[model samples]
Target: DLSEILSLHDFEAVARHTMNRRGWNYYSSGADDEITMRENNTAYQRIWFRPRILRDVTKVDFSTEILGHKSSMPVYITATALGKLGHPEGEVVLTRAAHEHGIIQMIPTLASCGFDEMVDAAAPGQVQFLQLYVNADKSRTKKIIEHAGKRGVKALFITVDAPQLGRREKDMRTKFEGNASSHQTKGGDKVQRDAGAARAISSFIDPSLSWKDIPFLKECAGDMKIILKGVQSWEDAVLAAERGCDGVVLSNHGGRQLDTAPAGITILPEVVAALNQRGLLVPPGKPRFEIMVDGGVRRATDVLKAVALGATAVGVGRPFLYSMSTYGFEGVCHMLQILKDEFEMNMRLIGAPTLTDVVPSMVDISALKVPTVGNTMFGVNYETMYPAGV
Candidate 1:
């Protein structure tokens, strides 16, 4: 079946046809009206590549480093919650797949499997990052970070956005209807049948998680790199660096939060400029601040575009889930291999032998600001497109 999957869209199509209705809607839906979700993907269409030729690109290497760890490509498995919704093996399937592909996986706080289970399942020395949702209980939060350090997570990507989880209508529509999610209602907590999967599980994310807590988190994390994960504006991006964090991921939570927030790619230029202007981008004698982008990334072309604009790497979640939900661990590995192949071929086509060569000049963002209405109906299903050669 994977042989029939030539593109990421194919994975989505197959997954949609195979995955449970509740899980599909929860995974595919975005925030209200889903404008930002569609725009995330469409934004890439606005930028065209200015490929170079006649260079010694015979060996287009895609290997890149994240927080000093080697990654086979400028791609990592961004954290997504409740992996059991899609597969029996849960998030550990992703853990194994990430190791096999030599990429990083950001473990989520809301994963179906306990944090230790995911961590314990990792192959030795496999790099994993933890995405945290600060709990109202400060002591518990401290303990979580401390345990992450002891377990050897490479980084802590503390989520700074989502003071309140967005109203994901598609996920809400399923709403467990009349049934309470047993997972979220442990210890005799009140059943919340009306709340969607996210709200049911994530009701405890501290809305008061301010910059003041960054120091506490850093101290708790010990030597682990502390990166803020939901930064959107250039000001916040700069503030994260000045606040003593190592980096910021310019993500809008895969368009799951804050509908109509600018897609992460469209804002990468300004974030870079803002940080560079402050001399904070890579301040003298300080660790080089990394900027990462996620959301609306489908093609390796999209990944290279972000790299060209200034992102050190990009986080991809849904497509990998789609592949996993459709084809299991093998499917996830195949999807990564597909990306690896795309990175190599696209790099040569664009005349970049390596990620560092994927500079700002390789892409034209002049059309990036231009926008048009995207079809919302397409969210539930992927409409496969064909090129002239196809």
Candidate 2:
């Protein structure tokens, strides 16, 4: 049954059936209206490809570096919280899978398993990055950063989008539902309570997180690359670069915050352009600042498209979670293998013998900004999957 799951979307279909109702809603639903969530996928459709022919593509390479770490592909598993909602092993499942495949995994601050536990589960010498949700207490935040630094975390991604949790209506509706005992904590306490998983777990995120704290975080991080996650605007991206931040992930918190925020891929050009205009887009051979994107990356073609637009790499979130939920560690490995196959085939078709060969000329994104009706297939399918009033 797991072998039949050939695509990332297939993993979602299985996860929808296998995961409990509350967990599914929490992982799948975005903020109110869910417009941004839908757009994240549809926007990719707007960018058409211009495949080249007559190029010898006997062997193609998908290997690349992210934040100075060697990865087998240009994609890395992005951070998603409360991994136990999908699997009992929590983020450790992803840790093992990513290590086996020679890819990086970003450990979530609010993981179901503790930070140290997840790192301990990793294969020896496996590269891991830490995603930080700044705590209201400065000392608490400092301690976490220092501990992660000691644990051999290669980078520190500071989440900047969620000072306050968004109103995810699906999760809100599921709040009164009974907790699944498997997801409970050591003290027999439910990891989530009445406020729904997002709100309940994010209470410690400091609302006052601002530019002034960047220098303090740099001091705490101590040589680990500090990248700002959830950066949307070109202005903010520019500021992140100017402030000595090592990189910026152009994300909207997977549309979980700010319902109408633009898709990460949609804003990639502007961010790259701004960085270039300021001479901050890292020059060749320098340990330079990186640009990354995460949201609605369902295929290897999506990864290729982002690279063409000048991203150092792309981050994938829900797909791996759904994969793990549906088939555990095997599902995760299979999903990566599927992506690898797709990347190879697509890269050859696009006439790119290597990742660096994937240039801006290979894609046509002129229709990206035009306001047209988006495909409502996801909405229709979602409604069919969870019909109104149950």
Candidate 3:
């Protein structure tokens, strides 16, 4: 049975064999020494969950709201490029799987297939958000956002972490085939290719983009809720909120952006705590911006840990890719099921019947030296602890 052929564990084992060695390395590679990527998992390992016994957990509810949209589960699929390479049907199959499972999928701008096609394949109005990587061409970026809006896409997830691609040593060594520039899924530019092979390309970062460019993006996005996907600092989080962005996805581009930066989970608290702090920093009536994080999240309990750490939502990247590569849509659906099931099971075991029951103190991060401003580790003000004055 193919299903039995590739259990979640088997996916990892098989992935090492089936993928282009360099490609696998690129997807798995962390920046510089990969210390942060290692830390993303180790930090979580350090936290021990204290499960409460004899709680009424027969009726477990895992549903939660992200940017006001109800998700059956707080965990969602991370935006990944080139679904076509993963399976014959690609995003079409993945979207159907996500729809079937009542989970969210973040469709990348660089998806091999068109967004409208994926939208039609999935359940109508499924909770799939479009992730945008603003291309070097501003017009291309605007056109993509406008198209997504017309297609009834629920949210606009702007990926700001990858302004410049990180030096992926694995891909570099193997000469992995693909163009980062054309990989984006939402934009209008057609990804020209030579038949079956991936194309070679260069960096897509628009160095010209300034803080002022955000208002233009806000105007372009119009009614589509905006989520900045690569925010790791409190300052950037606050900036996103002040600039009218509805949410900030606290991520380090899945450890794919910079090699030396902190892992998403490692930096989750700083972003969440800063955003939650009451101050003149944010607009008075501005509903606190959503904090969603992803990177090195390997288990359902990891999702629970992130939610407890103040993340409204958490993204799963490589795990879904592993499923897709190993068993196609059926595998992807099954993997999501396992994660959601595990999440609910763990939530009950931990005595948190509902998502709201999980709070900041759910996991003690004090052992970790997470810098706080009120304490003044430095002379910097509390707001300065964040990069953008939260």
Task: Give model 3's clash tally.
Answer: 9
What is the TM-score of each predicted model, taking all chains together? 0.92, 0.91, 0.85
Give lDDT tens digits, candidate 1, residues 1-390. 678888888899998899998889888989999999999999999888988788889898889898888999989999888777888888899999999999999998878778888889999999999999887778878988888889899899998878998989889877754222322223444445576777677666689989898889988988999999999888899889998999999999999999999899888887887787789988999878999999989999999999888888999989978888888899999999888889889999999898888877678777776545672321211012111221
- lDDT of each residue in 151-258, candidate 2, tens digit only: 999999999999888989888777734333211122333345686777666555679999999999999999899999999888999999899999999999888899
What are the clash counts of all predictions, listed in order? 0, 0, 9
Ten residues in sequence with the least summed lDDT for candidate 2: 377-386
| lDDT winner | 2
Cα miss at 123, model 2 (Å)? Answer: 1.3
- Please list the residue runs of candidate 1 whose C-alpha ends up more than 4 Å from where it truly belongs after superposition: 177-191, 371-390
In order, the Cα lDDT scores of the candidates are 0.84, 0.85, 0.70
Which one wins on TM-score?
1
lDDT of 3 at 217: 84
For model 3, how does the per-residue alpha-carbon lDDT over 22-75 read when each residue is reduced to its tens digit?
446655666667766677666677656656678788888999877777788888
As a whole number from 0 to 100, the lDDT of residue 40 in candidate 2 is 86
Candidate 3 off by > 4 Å:
1-10, 176-202, 279-286, 370-390
Candidate 2: where are CA atoms >4 Å away?
Answer: 176-192, 283-286, 371-390
Candidate 3 C-alpha error for residue 183, in Å = 8.0
